[model samples]
Target: MNILILGSEEDIHAAHLKKSLTEKGITVDYLDTRLFPTKLKITWQAITHTGCLIFPDGRKWDLADINKIFWRTFGGVNVPKLTDSYQERIAVNDSMGLLRSFMRSQPEKWVNSWEAYEFHKEKPLQLSLANKIGVTIPATIITNNADEILEFSQAFKDVIFKPVYGGSHTQFLTKEHLEINRMKLALSISPVTIQEFIPGTNIRSYVIGEKVYSAEIRSSSLDFREDKRAKLIYLETPEDMKKQCLAITKAFGLKWTGIDWRFKPNGDFFFLEANFSPMFLHFERETGCPITEELIQLLTS
Candidate 1:
């Protein structure tokens, strides 16, 4: 069987996956998206329902021949530089439109389909879907207006905020954050997700098909990822939790996912968010979870 990898060698996770596939004697194709529609070419024909990936170095791949794909990252396509502004706009539209079509076309081949990956970017929608499925989510408000955010701040004793589309680390929504000029400029540009901060242990559950593996993340920092010394402890997956995770994964039309939870000392946990492209080598090494094995099985099955 042949598998295609979208990310480049610089991404350690993608590198490891490619190496493992090679060791197992699987033919793997590399398609570094950073070079697309510029340094490389993609051709698809509706009549034949086939295409080819043409590399500058003369390597080629038939789309029909690839059995599966590991879309680690959609590392954006770089448009070729052009002196004419209008030409640049046309180039951008053409490249993006074609790439979007290519990505969404072969739904069965992608590990987690493009639809799932795109929906994961809409945090508010994610929460709503999970909530409808009986998952308890943190009390939250999404807004771009500074006044609305300031008003929401009054309701909670402890509040935290993070970018809706995700880039920066989570932080406390203090008075300094509401200072007029800074927030007005930023909020006017993009919205943020303000949530009632839940003081609980962080738990990460990985769901591959119907199987679940969970880890307890112990850290002193508000955001455990910022803490260099955070610890990961393996946890047995309760039967009910396993079913819930699988439901969430299916609800998002995903083959696999990483679901984060806030586990309270009182034995209750709140769903935080589900990640479409969660890094897992560290989780595997620390928890002794056979995530990669399951991933390979899923891809090659």
Candidate 2:
């Protein structure tokens, strides 16, 4: 079977997956979004719904032959030092537009389709569904209003904040951050997601189809990722928790997802966020979960 990995060529996760798939005697190719317009070409016939992907070295692959597309990354050269800014935007957008058109026209074989990407972007909706499912979730608010931010911070004494759309590291809302002027200036640029900070073990559950593999991430830092020495240890998910994880994944319409949680001291887990394209090489290596194997199976099947 020929599988397409939709990700950057430099993405370690994609590279690892390519290696694994190739070892299994599967033909694997990377569809790095960044390589378009400059190093590659795309063409499609409207009437026939036929198309082929042209690579840099004159190699072309008929789009129909692709068995499955492993949805990993979406977007064109995220960091291109093009000579012209305006032109760069046009180039990237144009390339992405056509690529998306092709993606939209293709048959349904995406591991987690473009729709999953849309669902992931709406954190508010995801959290709401989690809460409705009876899953524990921290009280949270998303807004750019400085007054509301300060009010929420004051109400929940200990609170943490991050980007509403997910990018920056989570930071505690400190006493000094209560200043309206500072918050107004910073938040005016973009909306911020502030949540009541829950102290507990950092847990991540990888839901692949009907299986849920979990791990306890140990770190001294507020954001486990900030700690270079952070460790991921395998953990058995409680039957109840497993059901919740599966529900969350299905609710999100995700074929594979990484659900972050906070296991509070009271033996309860507070739902954090669900990652549609979470990196898993580290989790697999440390926890010995068959993450790659399952993903490969999903794509090849």
Candidate 3:
């Protein structure tokens, strides 16, 4: 079986997966999206009515021929020294757009298409989906109006603010004591998402095909990255929690994803969000789970 592990050169999990699949006698190839040249051609095949991806190097990697495609990253490269944003945007957009169409052509096998992977980038949409799946979610509000912010703050007393779009520019999930100050509204020009603080323990559920594992993450600070002094610990999750993790992944049409579930102080599981392509090696070392082997089995099956 031929497998393609789509990711960036900096992605550690993708590297590990490639090693595991190779050990299992699968022909695994790594395609770093950043290495894709600025030029690519997409042609519609009249016979199949599907788009074909042609690399600038003249190598043809057909989507239909791939036994499995583990999408490790999507739309994450910055063309260095580009003066024009339009040019850079076009290059990245075209690559991902073509890649998305290619993946959509496949009807079977384990694959994480760009469309399925993109669901995690939107926090509000994820929360809505979680609610529909009978998973507990915190109360949230998105608005730019000053009056609305004040009202929600007064009602909820304690709230956490995060960006609607996921990016590294801002921080996430900082536990703040209720101190309603209306002037903070002027900090941004866009609508801000404020949610009721769901106090709980942090748990991450890693799902690859039918193999699912859950681990509790313990961090002293609300924003784990903020305080370097803070430490992280991983603990195995109960069997019932593993079932919930699997259900969440299937609902997202995802064969591989890392789910973040917070156990609130009230002894309940609240769905935070899913990481479409999460790092597995480090987690496996901490939790002692054989995620790499499972990925290989799915591709080879």
Candidate 4:
């Protein structure tokens, strides 16, 4: 069986996965989305139900021969430098749309299908599903209304705000932030997600199939992603939490995922969010977890 990795060449995680899979004597193909339609060629025939992908290096892969795909990241395709920015934007959108449709057509072949990732990536949807599955979640409000936000803030002494989409960092809503951005809030055009601050040790659980590798993260920053001083230590997965994680993975139709939770002093756990394509190099490097090996097994299995 052959595996295809859909991500950028510069991605370290992708590089690790490819190297490991290759070392196992598995046939692997790499496709960088950013070079689509320019350095790569895709041919498909609806009547024959056949498709072919030609890589930039002149390697050819038949769709039927590819047993699995690792959809890591779908970066923007490179477009010819154009004087008209709108045209370039249109070209990018068209390329993405075409690729998405093709991937969705073969959802069963993806590690975590593109359709599942798209559906679960929505924070509100995932939170609702988590709550239904008996996972504790912090009180969250997604809104653009200034009055509503002010009222919501009254319920919690501390709250954190983040973008509804494409936000990599989290920030606390301090008095200074409120006062300085009061005008901007009043005129806000986009909605933001605000959640009551839950204080505790951060736990990152990397779930691949039935295996779970967890790490307890201690960080001084509000968002651990920005905390360079953070430390990681592997923790044995709790029986109940392990079941819940598996349930969540199945619910999202994901074969692999990274789940983040906050463990309160009282031993209560609060669900933060699920990462479809999580960065696992840090955890593996710090704790020596066999994440990449597990990922390869999941794909090949």
Best-matching candidate per TM-score:
1
Using alpha carbons, what is the TM-score of model 2? 0.91
The Cα error of candidate 3 at residue 171, in Å, is 6.8
What lDDT does the true structure give each of the candidates? 0.88, 0.87, 0.68, 0.84
Candidate 1 Cα deviation (angstroms), residue 286: 1.1
Q: Candidate 4, residues 3-74: lDDT per residue as tens digits?
A: 988886689888888888899999886778778868987777778877878889898888888999997877
Q: Which pairs clash inside model 3? A: 200-263
Ranking by TM-score: 1, 4, 2, 3
Model 1 Cα displacement at 70 (Å)? 0.7
lDDT by residue (tens digit), candidate 3, 1-301: 7787776456777777787778878777765555544544455565775554466677676655667777876544434546898987887777666555555667364467666766667778878887887777888777666567667776765577776775532234233422234335443457677778777777788787877777767776665445555434655666766777788788887887888877866668878778877777767777778777777666677
lDDT per residue for candidate 2 within 8-95, as digits (tens), equals 6688999999999999999999887677767778898888988889877888888898888888887655436689999888877877
User: Candidate 1 — which residues are off by over 4 angstroms?
Assistant: 179-185
Q: Which candidate would rank higher by TM-score, 3 or 4?
A: 4
- The local lDDT score (0 to 100) that residue 139 gets in candidate 4 is 97
Which residue ranges in model 3 land beyond 4 Å of their true spot?
Answer: 35-44, 49-59, 76-97, 107-110, 168-188, 227-236
| Residue 147's lDDT in candidate 1 | 88
Please give the TM-score that candidate 4 achieves against the real structure.
0.92
